[model samples]
Target: MKGRAIAGIALILLGAYLFFMRDENISTGSVFAYFWPTLFVIPVGILLHWLYFGVFGRSAVGVLVPAGIVTTTGIVCQIATLTDGWSYLWPGFILAVAVGLFELYWFSGRNKALLIPINILAGASLIFFVAFSISNLLGKLALGQPFLAIVFILAGAFLLAARKSTP
Candidate 1:
């Protein structure tokens, strides 16, 4: 537990430093300049946890490390987005849903009830995201724009509910 706490604190400090550092103004665009390599820590943390679990069979620390890393990454991203004027919400939300679905598929037991709700929520969120993107792109369509979003949301909900009710 102490090790996990230390790792968590380290991740937070590293993220804070990365986000708060002074930006160097330059015209030449470099790949490293556009992307922060430190973000890879999240996946590296997940991999470390997986390896530990595989070797030791099972341990609470194994879970804590990965969860801590992901949570820290999310916090950093959220803070950076809000403070730095970066649009992180959409991508963050999508990544979170994808991760949740992957976890459900990989780790969950065969329980139809739990799976159905998760699928429905995932489907709805995906459809809403798509609708939002489309609406933004079709700004000139100027005819019942909000209605289109509502239609998409309703369609997604109906399809998910129907699938759930079906065999």
Candidate 2:
């Protein structure tokens, strides 16, 4: 029964692919671009989860490492694709590895040793993401004397004026 189901699914997928490709106006690239997350990443993540939970049980928590990786990659790519933010968002790839390591640390008996690399990788990924994204967000905040002067003046004025007034 399982083999039959698998064969049926494959047949359906192949038929769908051929049916879609039959259209001359539709380029395969456009048709398949969004298919990767569904066809590969999602299935791979689910399979990893199934292995850990359904098949091997808690003893195989290590499978979550790859599951985390694939899931993160899919999320990052989906966000990038939707928002057209491929530029600074590339730091997510580094963050993805960190996430996988963190999952391994969390699930695999909470090994204290893994904390070091997990913290380092996650910290570095965040730092890079912040640094890279700031350039796009504030344009370096127009780092000039005028900007600093305004900020300082505002802070000083606000502090002095907002202080409690004696009756």
Evaluated with TM-score, which candidate comes out highest? 2
TM-score of 1: 0.40
**Candidate 1: segments with Cα more than 4 A from true spot:** 1-41, 48-53, 56-95, 140-167
Give model 2's TM-score versus the native structure: 0.63
lDDT of 2 by residue, 68-147 (tens): 88888877875565446777788888888888888888777789988898888788889989977866555447755566
User: RMSD to the native, candidate 2?
Assistant: 7.6
C-alpha lDDT (0 to 100) for residue 155 of candidate 1: 97
lDDT of the structure predicted as candidate 1:
0.53
TM per candidate: 0.40, 0.63
Q: Cα lDDT of all candidates, in order? A: 0.53, 0.76
- Candidate 1 lDDT over residue span 1-167, tens digit each: 97998799667755655565547443334323333433454555456556545664344333533444464456445454435523323544544544444444445454466566556655765786676656655664764668778889999998888855566
